[model samples]
Target: MAERLTTQQVAEQLGVKVETVYAYASRGQLSSERAPGGKGSTFDAREVAELAARGRRTPMRPNAAGEPPAGEPWASRPVTVRTGLTLIENGRLYYRGQDAVELAARHGFEAAIGWLWGLGSDAPVTLRVPPATAEALARASAALPDGIRLPDRLRISATVAAALDPLRFDLREQTVQAAGAALIAGMVEALPRTAPDPGPDASLAARLWSRLASAAPAPEALACLDRALVLLMDHELAVSAVAARVAASARAHPYAVVSAGLGATDGPLHGAASPLAHRLLGEVLVGGAVPVVSDYLRTGRPIPGLGHRLYPEGDPRAVALLDAVGRLDGGAAVVAAVAEVEAAAGPAGRPALRANIDLALAAMALAAGMPAEAGEVVFAVARTPGWLAHAVEEYREEPLRMRARGSYTGPRPSEGPERPEHPVPSSS
Candidate 1:
């Protein structure tokens, strides 16, 4: 029989308290078996000796500010959640092995959706809002006050659609695709239209333009917006997509998954970036780029739309969409302003700061005479398809597989709330 060491022996060998030995066992750092005749738990003697030599018992100490040091690299580790939707690397975005930039320029958003939805490139695409669904969204949205934000209006409309869809709970592949299309279409049709309807066969960009801006439909501007939507469709493991997947992992109905995604998108650091960037662009146009950018830097705030962490060189999506914007009428002025901001806001001696998709989206809206808030609406709507795609993937996984394990740091069950044994001795 292999030799074994008692808990006390193991603790002494590792130079930690006995309680720490128990803690290590609880954490699965060391395994033990019940001792013969139930004396106590015993660990493999050889394993204990190896652990002692390795000095893993060195207590993890806090920094000067009392913050604990970093632990396991769970956040950055390469764990798998199989997806072929979009790949982001070297500042480029790809959808299921095809270049996103090329697709945006060559095909409109419809073809891109077919690719993302696991359908072949030649699959027929049809997206439509049922007349009843549109009417229901309109009535639900009309009940809200006029000042409600566009995303909030979208949330209310989505809830209405969920309530109306009788087959929303169906998780079959075909049912999911049908439900996703209706949800996206309802969101678009519910937006208050300012221009005349562009007819049923119009591209989503054209339909959305009527709702967002009063400017008459120009083919170039509409095409620019279409490419923007296609490019923005999906980005792997983005926070909002993770939120949608988490909901879907719980087998949530399609509408619930979308609602979860929309909730994450409302966070200022994410979906709101476009509107903030639009405002920054307006400020640069009015106040002169150099002074406005210099002022923003002095305040220690990130210059909106100037840099993205994921793209060290630059965002390819921004490059493609901004190029399209530059090709549109009256786009040269916006391009010049963008160039000025890039030069002025960039850090000295470092690589030139690169513009991100938010910058490109803001520039597109400004050049096209759309309202600043319209960019945020566009982002939310464009990202809906990607969220649904993640939802579909999550549906196939075991329920709650994404659930996280908590490492409790609180007092043990035996150690209840502190109470002086002798009533604190009547401290005066």
Candidate 2:
């Protein structure tokens, strides 16, 4: 159900004055949105509760373990609920509690990144590009050898080339941010093109769809891509985001942080799941469906696309991605293919067993002619904005660089009374 809380209501819930609530919003601690027709600011009911919950955690581990009845006490691992997946949980995101989904939905791609960076949504995409790097971009564009197909590779390589130039060592935050933005914008502008007509919307997902489709997409397809971005935007510090934020907590620049994010994403456990889903979907798409799914069921395998750790009901992002794609004519056959496999698997019991975002997203990507490997690209690119936001947050309340003590769990050898095993024999 849709629920909006008044400022006063939100204040009471948090035990803060109404003015203090607005102050928090202003400082980027929490967010509020002005309703349509500019009537009034609306605070989300659940978000208020979330803030209360966060405050109550105190964000620190207790020094002592809880004592058991007899002797030893068990130490509990410190638990902190990550805020990165706000996009997924609430179907919205905040730069500093600012609405990212709304801006991305309403504005252009560059505008959305700007919104996340606390810049005006309408700012120009071109920021300062170091002169030497700009020259490198010029040289790379000149050397493209004409008619090469892979746009992302060209973009990625060009970025690696340009950013590696000696000038990049400046390490200033403003400098690094500009360099990162330029690398992205420059890549978009320089990618191999047939006619050079207006490409995708230049927004994150639209560009991703363009990358996958390899051509200008229709309006319907673009809308679908937008929804995909919102859905996959953030996913609760999924291992990749967590790794990236850990690096960022060390004052890593935006590009380096993103590179780390991409590295973590490249790992099999995180982003490769999507490509695996593509293969699973392909199995269903071929061979008239039933025999294949039955064979898959016998393998004692958890179906690839059908489950996730979070999202008890289902991966909202998966549902959102599928909704964006609409009913592609042959899509029913694929869904049927997966459904049969699920039927064989029997009833779902845990959130971990539910089909997650990766499956449907893979289907959407495949139907659109995306190469399987491109799933990582699609996911990583779509998630970059969200990752950047998390990086910024980590910086704002930078965690103290943590240290650890070594446990003496190594090994020990001691003289022991001899016991003979010679008398025993195997049953065989």
Tell me the tens digit of each residue's lDDT in model 1 across 328-417.
Answer: 887878877888888887778866687888989999989988888888888888899999999988887656556564567996786667
User: For each candidate, what TM-score against the reference?
Assistant: 0.81, 0.61
* RMSD for each of the candidates: 9.9, 15.0
- Model 2 off-target regions past 4 Å? 1-108, 119-176, 186-207, 327-344, 348-354, 397-408, 411-428
**Candidate 2 lDDT (Cα, 0 to 1):** 0.58
* Index of the highest-TM-score prediction: 1
> Which runs of model 1 end up more than 4 angstroms from their true locations?
1-79, 410-428
For all candidates in order, the CA lDDT equals: 0.83, 0.58
- Location of the lowest summed lDDT over 10 successive residues in candidate 1: 70-79
- Give the alpha carbon lDDT tens digit for every residue of 24-103 in model 2: 67766567899778876878787777767765553432221322211111111222435533544444335446454454
Clashing residue pairs in candidate 2, if any? 109-203, 306-354, 306-355, 307-354, 307-355
